[model samples]
Target: MPRVADGSIPGGPRHVALIMDGNGRWAQQRGLPRTMGHREGVRALKRTIQAAPDFGIECLTVFGFSTENWSRPAEEVSDLMGLVRTYVANDLKRLERAGVRLRVLGRRTGLPDDIAAIVERAEQTTAHNDRFLLQVAFNYGGRADIVDAARKHLDRVLAGETGEALTEDILGAGLSTVGAPPVDVIVRTSGEQRLSNFLLWEAAYAELIYQNVLWPDYGPEALADVVTQYRNRDRRFGGVESATARVVG
Candidate 1:
């Protein structure tokens, strides 16, 4: 692991979101099954969850499986679903030991009953953990999130709840990540430059980082590099840069 002299990320983001990409590509390049790359990605996820707090991040959200991914070949999708089951079965206790809270943010209408039960149990088991919150955006899409929130809000309005405020806070409450903090930095691995429908609302003013390394290969060193790059940026947030802007711990 790369260590900073100060033992923290300078100007580190409070909330970091990762679009973990390139699993299939990584497998293709290595002449292996895509499932193998996904398995490695899971290992990388474990490393990231363990290292995130040390880097000064309070919240971490990963784009684990997108709704669009269901369009892939049936065998691959099944494999991915199996991977999710395996992850929950194997990592629940370890995550609890690390004080990591597991949160899943997505629609679960079509998910298998057993998998949904596993997700619910994992969440319940880690609800009281305070060290870090890890949100997995499984079967998630940014546009879908917005639409769902809007529909929920409309439903409330239709139920004789008149004059209800429709502010950002209200809309945010209706979204999957209802109480989570906004994302401050969004990182996409595999050299991808697009958001690909991840955290559209929360990441409005986030610092974006792109890495050439695939998700399976991303580790603590890569995370440190992203934080270093973030520290070097000028985040004006639509305002004039502060004359005496300084990095935070």
Candidate 2:
């Protein structure tokens, strides 16, 4: 219930999106296989999920794989696929046990059948849990998501729904994260400053923070540090402070 000096809400972000980058670089720097870095990055994600509730963040959306990642070397792509399989096989139960709702976003048409099945199973297993939300963006791209939403919107218009009117709220509701709040903070590891086609629409007003540490090195302490930065920001939503400025001055 506390208000910031600028009369803005002073609290932790409700939704946090993480761009987990630099896995390959982390492995190369240590003369190890790139897969090893990905393995460690998954561990980092586990630690962050365990620590997210403590930070009061309701939703945690992570960029695991992008649509463009398919262009990587075949061997590396296969390694990534195997890592995802292992993580789901071994960690699905752990996530469900912790009351974390799982949602896998993006296209699945080209994925292997078994892998697709596992994705569905994970979502079904934790569908009822409401304590926390974890969105795994596999094969996801921001432009593609917007295109998909636009197509769905067209269907409604052709059906004579509401005089064919279109609005931001209506279009956003058609995306994968229909019921969720907008992204509040976007954290990119390995010092990446750009969105890289991850959650472009949802991150319209999110506070962007680029960390120098690689994805594998990001842990609970790093998450806490970034969250502290979020809490200190003055979110005015394009409005300037009026009475609060006079009172604080």
Candidate 3:
């Protein structure tokens, strides 16, 4: 991992989520096919995955594909799916060797059977690794996640298990990311400031960092900057801090 001029990130977040944007724009800027940008973005993903453990991050969730992404040109979508297959086929063993557990959080109904099979196989193979949990939100949408969880909860209630008195814990249990820690910080690249339907429920209190850097160009140094910014903030969670407690020891 490449280190910044300074030492390690101070008080880095435990869980980080990323909305990787601007692949198409990056490719357009370079006079290359958009598919090439996606290809390069994969390289960036590899870099981030390798660097996360170095920063002591326990979990990293990346927005690989959203439900809305299906609306893009069919050719582009197909290319993205091919990229997914390539990543799993080419990198799964390396990821497992590095102690990274792979998890996919999304509805798999629309994925090609072969692609879905690869996802399942990758998850099963990496299930025992514990150094870090890497979640790829492929074909995922925050609102869709909430609705799916709610439907499951309602079904349980109707089946005489528990009725109408659902709490956050009960609801959360049905979500795809039930056991994972909530996102601590969310970074959106490509100068976009919107969350774009990524992890709405889990990111309720997450500090967000928007960067002008495109996804294909993001590296460990950019990630370190996000961590540095997170460390500088005073996270009071919604309460006023005691005067003495507010002072840094």
Candidate 4:
């Protein structure tokens, strides 16, 4: 619950999901290697983590590597994997020092054993840290997550736990971010206007903002601006009429 510099805004979103895109296009536009953009994007991620609390963000879910990203060039994929390794192996301690809890939200069945081990270590190390929750969506797809949740409920039902119909709460308990608050805002960088298969279930009522700024260029100021925009939004969920409408009628 870190306060902004102005300390005027009392509260803001507890959860924010980000679609970090345009690394390859950004590098190509600058006539540099895409790897450089990825590296810079990591820097931007660190900056965002540092700025999260100032914006009143309790949980941050970032789309790190989607399942579809595996179709990219082999070298780029390797570079991306290397970055994951570097983050989990090296930067994890930094997260620990910063009191940020790290959670990887995705399938881990066929992942590299080394990355899996590091992920285990990171999660264990930060399990008790209550300061911040950071969810990295690696090998994650929204549809796949929902399917997994369904399968989990099915298994429970088969075990005779509940013979009745499945409710949203029952299924939500199986989600990776079950304990955290639902996403309040979704921000995509690099001018991308699509969810790109990010958080499907949790974003049912999320306010989305697409920015033209590349992921590598997103900094603390960008985060502040995004939060400012979120603050100005009118979140009515679905209902347009208030309780007083019945009295008026």
In order of appearance, the predictions have TM-scores of 0.93, 0.91, 0.93, 0.91
> What is the C-alpha lDDT profile of model 4 across 1-249, one tens digit per residue?
335576534446678899998787888899999999999899899999999887778899999988888899999989988998887777888888889999999998767898788778889999988889999999899998989999998998899987868789888888877888789899999987989889999889898999889998888898887877776676767888532233222
lDDT of 1 by residue, 1-249 (tens): 354685655567778899999998999999999889999999999898888888888899999888898899998888888988998989899999989899999988888898789889999999999888999999899999999998888888889785686788788888898778778889999998999999998888888999999999988998888777777778877889741274442
Best by lDDT: 3
* Stretches of model 3 off by over 4 angstroms after superposition: 1-10, 242-249
Model 2 agreement with the true structure over 1-249: per-residue lDDT tens digits: 344554333466779999999898999999999989998898899899998877777899999899999999898889889988999999999888999999998988889898899899999999999989999999899999998888898987888775657789878988887777678899999987899999989887788989999999988888888877887676665678632344333
Estimate the overall C-alpha local distance difference test score of candidate 1: 0.87
Give the backbone clash total of model 1: 0
Model 4: ten consecutive residues of lowest lDDT: 240-249
TM-score preference between candidates 1 and 4, better one: 1
- In angstroms, give how far residue 119 of model 3 lies from its true place: 0.9
* Model 1: worst 10 consecutive residues (lDDT sum): 240-249
Q: Clashing pairs in model 1?
A: none
Provide the lowest-lDDT 10-residue window in model 3.
1-10
Candidate 4's displacement at residue 243, Å, is 13
Q: What is the C-alpha lDDT of each candidate?
A: 0.87, 0.86, 0.88, 0.85
